[model samples]
Target chain A: MFRDIAEWLANSPAREFSAGLLSSIPGLPPILQTVHLLSIVAIMASIVLIDLRILGLAVPSQQLDEMIVRLRAWTVWGVIGAIISGILFVLARPNRYLLNPVFQIKFILLIGVLILTVCFYRWSAKNPFSHEPGNNIGIAKGVAVVSLLMWIVVVMAGRWIAYSEYLFWPG
Target chain B: MLNEFFLWLEYLPLAQHIGATWWFPLMESLHVVSMTLMLGTILMVDLRILGFAANRYAISTMSSELVPWSAVSLTIASVTGVAMFITRASTHAVNPALQIKMLLMVLAAINIVTVHCYVFRGVVNWDAGKVAPFSARFSAGCSLGLWVGVFLAGRWIGHIV
Candidate 1:
């Protein structure tokens, strides 16, 4: 059954799409994964610092905007890491990855993270919290909370992909 | 000594299941992902402290802000790391390398805790002499060394004992 599905995908649009990606970038995928991992490390640090602040675990005296400014470079680095690694990983084994449900979920969560970052973190060097200190209570907190949650899921799903056996799904 | 450790850690149950099937590969990948995620965050924070970047942004601000994310990332890494451990309980439980790794982890955790406690505890005490106190710098440096050891030990599990 799995073989048959693989065969079908071989002729399908996805196969062509994945093949095209590989053809376009011969040795880029592995390099992307390496860089991606490194960037993720950087981003993770920035994110946790900010998130910890949100949870009030440590260092509450600093302004939220100031924190964001400092974290910006790292956050940007992290996003770049995740995106490139993800694309490269996907390209390396597109059909199998696309067939997996976990990948789908990961992409969704990734989108959520991106959206959250964009919604609140637009400026290259400004803080969203300073304009309305008290109003920064609920939604701002929710954004931070969900951003962390989505990243967790994304990492889990990425790992789960390696473990999954169900390749030919929704046929 | 290393060979003897190699003999010791490759116990029966785990020895039988190191590469038994597809699940091991999956779990291993998950373990990598979880670790990378955690390490990723750690790198950012430490870099900030070292003044690699984020100079304008106060250390306290960055530290407080990243606290929540760090907690969550670490939680995920620990949970997945344990799951990986369960897959090979007996051998890993007694393995010298794992023991060393665990010790390093404890040390790392202590450093992190100190950062939050005595080091970062008085953020409002910002002063001319107050960029990152000696204690904070030492903790950060310890944190880096411990985590590197952790990563190296983890990868060395395949070759080392």
Candidate 2:
């Protein structure tokens, strides 16, 4: 079922147009890749600081709300940038990525991390943390650790997609 | 000059071994991971100093908390980066993107020293939620720009080479 969808999307008009245009432009792919990487850096930075705080390893004196408020915009922008650039990247080489196992894993992890981030945000909102560090330190630390692990997997899978031996489906 | 040194490095047994095997990929992955960690921590500190984020936190405290991790990652990144460089010394030595990356890193290092030695001495006055003084803000701005440039240049190296 998933392969059928991928195959259908690969032959779609939008994909064809995007791939043609992206390839015709000189340096677009690399520029998009660079943007994608910078976005990843920004996303990781915001999440790492937040995760470290939740783990009680950083900025212990500052209230969690203050840190989150400041970093929220950065985190949002990073997510938006990543998704936009990531889509364009896939559009450029749909067939190559659709069948790639590493790409498939990365796509799944991306969805998982997105869901995890939403849950974390909801949790933080409901239980506002201050300088007291809270009685639920263990739960907060668990969330942070899980978030960090999910993102690490996502990043590794994305990088390894290029290095993986399998790039295409057997016709 | 250092061209001869770079040439000598290219023939080193470690360099050859890394180039001939999976070591290159492994080291490359480690290098990227280290760079990400180092840059992420540095960005946090710089963001705090620039009065852009984490304003409630004391700048001194943020520095003390984050800079050590940044330093550790920088050490790892430097080691992995030099290892990769030695494997293709002649090529990287002349690569424009790499040259720019190294020079920008040096500038960033100098900026770090200048900030810590001079601007940071008076940080007690503005360590809290107060906006950083112009000199400190300027240093932070430079640090952010230089590090971003370093990352871009580093990424561009693969394309250029």
**Per-candidate local distance difference test:** 0.64, 0.81
> How well is each residue in A1-171 modelled by candidate 1, as lDDT tens digits?
434555676676765676677568745444454455556666655665566567665446656677677777777877876776576446546567766777777777788787777766774234466676676646667767887777766766675675565442455
Task: Provide fnat values for all models in the order shown.
Answer: 0.42, 0.35
Q: In candidate 1, how many clashes are counted?
A: 18
Individual DockQ of the candidates? 0.28, 0.46
DockQ score of the complex predicted as candidate 2? 0.46
lDDT computed for candidate 1: 0.64
Please report the candidate that would top lDDT against the real structure: 2
What number of clashing residue pairs does each candidate have, in the order they appear? 18, 0
Winning candidate number (TM-score): 2
Q: Mark the regions of model 2 whose C-alpha exceeds 4 Å error after superposition.
A: A24-26, A130-135, A166-171, B1-4
Q: Assign candidate 2 its CAPRI class.
A: acceptable
User: Over the stretch B1-161, how does candidate 1's per-residue lDDT look in tens digits?
Assistant: 75455455455466446546555655566666567756755665676676665555577666655556567767766866765665566666677768888989998888887787778776566522335666766776787778877875665454333
In candidate 2, position B148 carries an lDDT of: 84
